[model samples]
Target chain A: MTVLLDVRGLNVTIGGKPVCEQLDLTIEANQSWALLGRNGAGKTTLVHQLAGLRPVEAGRIRINGHDLTELSPKARAREIGVLLQHSSRGFGASVFETVLSGRHPHLSTMAWENAEDHAIAKRAIARLGLDALSERSLDTLSGGELRRVELARLLAQETSLCLLDEPMNHLDLAYQASSLDVLYQTYVAPSRAMLMVLHDPNLAYRACDHWLILLGDGHWRAGPRDSVADPALLSLTYGHPIERIDSTHGPVFMPRTSLEGAPDNHDAAD
Target chain B: MPTAQHKRILVLALFAGLVSLWLATSTGGTAIPATEVLTHLLSNDGSTHDEIVDRLRLPRALSAFAVGGLLALAGAFMQVLLRNPLGDPYILGISGGASAAVLGVMLLGLPAFWHTPGALVGALFSTLLVFGLSRGAGDWRSERLLLTGVVIAAGWSALISFVLSISPPVRLPGMLFWLMGDLGDADRPLLPLLLMSLGLAIGLLRARDLNLAARGLTQAASLGVNTARLRLELYFLGALLTAAAVATAGAVGFIGLIVPHMVRRLGGTDHRILLPAAALLGGALLVLADTAARSVISPMQLPVGVLTALLGVPTFLFLLHRRVRT
Candidate 1:
């Protein structure tokens, strides 16, 4: 398999706390990887590092055989698109204008969007079901609608690799499924890959072909889903007892809850 | 590309600006008739109107227009940089720094032209100070930059107060007029006009990146915008524009804060349209305000800054109220 993204000896720290230490990762083409970790496990930091927004303390990141540091942010951005956890919406730009901004990586600073750029943005918007909201101001949208608009913007970016901090945030079940479906269909091509931070184990299990689980204190496990999605490893990573139940559809991982006889009367009343 | 509505608004603003410029030139202290004003302006008939038009009112009007345009453009950039609706040229204390410097010059009994250079120096100093302090060994967040500017502005305000309190009574009126944003003393319009055009051109060229920046730094960076470079350029441009405006018109208020917001409400938020539209509207607004400032009291001209606030406050409130109603 051709490697699309390679990370070697990555050392990242936030507030003097070591988040990622001597970590190495290799993502191959046509692979979708889910990043699972507890809160404060540096998921967003890692995403930022991959996107070239944050500096890696000690590491070499190569995208398609080019050193990430050697490339300018704009050049790196052409190969790797990112969707951050939160974005400011105070500018009051319309959806069309906002999505068109996603084409900045492909165009020069002085060049305005051409017909082709507009077509790409329009197709992305249509694919994400944002055509109805194209002219509406972004501030007027609900949280879910805004998330979809951002996803459309990511799609409009049209990069070879996508780094999504939390793709499922602020989305309903329907949108969650549809967004993942769109991501799967659009990005899981011969030369494309995606790395997403997900909180839901079921969605990760169902959608991702590879997994990278970060256990706190500079330890992590990364491999194919079949090799890394062990229930005990996940339980240790999350500090909870996890149980895998095989349903008719597929395997589902859930937190194991202790079932006692009956609760005390006082506890029950409370 | 601007839509039909945007085009219409632009045409209307241009028309209004032309009319306001004519009115400002014709209705000054010596009320030259419009026909004679135009005739002499077109023909250079050596009439006394020629002297007034060429010497006093024309430079003043152009200076006012350029100053207004610069402030508004700076305000628009600041709003995008800080990602706050309330962002304005004065928010970073550029005006405070200039005011303090100008007040100090006045207190020292310096020549009139010295205040301009002094104000420019002070503005640049304050900007560098805020920029340096906000970038201390960590991430460059807009909130931190804003906070640093606000605090530094407060410091400048205290310094201005100290200078004002010690100034002689003879220089008090001049100091007060400058603080209130007077255009009467604006002798040279060329530098401000040049700076205004340069800012507008640069702003238009980078409008798309600015639009991305308005979404946030991370978003802009992810979209291939060199956010750090963009921020640095904006800061430098915004500071330069503010310095030029302050030097030209003594820290005019309200035009910077309200003009961009007004334009955004009328025309959508595309910076390509928004930047030029704000320039035209801002130039028109100030010319009209200056006209009112000179004519309202006849022999005793009110400071243009006071008139801008008086006119801008009610108009801005009306626009906000209308938006809420809609």
Candidate 2:
């Protein structure tokens, strides 16, 4: 399989807290990977480092055959599309205009959007079901709607590797399924790959074929979903009791939050 | 960011500007026929109106127009840079620096030619100081830049007052008039007009990138804009335009602060359209204000800055009220 993203010895630290030490990761084409961790696991920081927004402390990242740092900003943008967790807006423009801005890396600074560019933006908007809101101002949209707009922009970007930090933010169950389905369908080729940060293990299990978990304090595990999505490893990482139930559809991972999960353990009562 | 309706409004604004220029030239000091003003504008008829049209009224009116254009164009960029709808060309205290330097030069009994260059130097110095000092340990956020500029502006204001208080009484009248934005010595509009045109061109060329910049710098960078360069463009381009306008007529009020808001309120938010619309609207507003200033008290003019504020405040309020109502 062709490797799309190669990371070697990535030393990620934020505020003197080591996230991972000498982390090596390789994402091949046609793979969907989930980056799983609890809060403060440096998941966002790691994604940002990979997105080229944050500096990589001591590591090398290669996209396709070229060094990530050596690529021009425009070239890198064409290779890696990112969906950040939170977006800040100074002033609002229309949804269509916002989506069209996704094509910035493709055009020269002064070039106007041509027919093909507009068509791509339009298709993205349609895929994300944002056609009705295309002409509406951004400030007028709700949280869920805005997330869809951002997803549409990412779709319009059309990059080979998508680093999506919490792509499920503010999404309802219906949108979560439809949007991820659309995204996976669009990138279901040997030349494209996706890595997303998801909070729910079940969601990650369903959406991704591979799992990478941050165990905190410079430790991590990476492998196929079944190898790394172990109940004991997740319970240790989250500092809680977790139980994996073999459902009719698939195994579902759940935390032991209620009394029924351990009926005899009165010591764990809230 | 743009639509056909925007283009229609641009054409309408251009038409309004022409009529305003005519009104400014024809109705000051002495009432020349409006048709005669048009005739002289079209061709040199060598008539009696030639002295007023070619010499007296035309120069001053064009000076007001260009200064207005410079301020509003700079204002358009400032709003995006600071991410504030109320952002003004003078918000960073460029006018305060210019005023202090120009007043200092006048106090020393320097030749009139020194005022423009002195103002330019002082404005640039203030810009550099804010830029250099506000760049602390982290990102050069707008909040840091704005704070540094406002504080330095206060210092410049203090210096201006000290200069005014200690100036020989004989030079006080000229200093005061200039401070209140006099166009008496603005007989040459060539430089300011050129500066406004150049600024307008750059604003248009980078209009699309400006749309992204308006959203936020991080987002703009993610979209592949060289944000460091764009940030520099915002700072220096704004300072250059403002310094030129202030050099012509010392710190005209209301035009820089209000015209961009007015244009945006009128639905010219796209920088491609907003930049040019602001240039036209701002120019015409100042021309009419200057005309009213000279003619309202006839023979004794109120400061053009005072007239701009008095006229602009009500129009802006009305527009805002209309938006709220609808």
TM-score of each: 0.93, 0.90
Please report, in order, the local distance difference test score of every candidate based on alpha carbons. 0.84, 0.83
Q: Give the TM-score of candidate 2.
A: 0.90
Candidate 2 lDDT, A78-143, residue by residue in tens: 999888897644456778888988898898866777889899999999999999999887767888
Once superposed on the true structure, which residue ranges of model 1 sit more than 4 Å away at CA? A258-270, B109-113, B128-154, B311-326
Worst 10 residues of 2 chain B by lDDT: B317-326
DockQ of 1: 0.70
lDDT tens digits by residue: candidate 1, A1-270: 889999999998888877778889999999999999999988898888888888768989999999988888788889999988875565678888888888888887677788998999999999989999999988789888888888898898889999888888889999999999999998888899999999978889899999998887788889989899888998998999988888998889988765535556787778
lDDT tens readout by residue for model 2, B114-187: 87788777877887787688778755666677678779888988888899899888878877887878787788
Q: How accurate is candidate 2 locally (lDDT)?
A: 0.83
DockQ of every predicted complex:
0.70, 0.50
Clashing pairs in 1: none
Measured with DockQ on alpha carbons, how good is candidate 2?
A: 0.50
**Residue A136 C-alpha lDDT in model 2:** 86
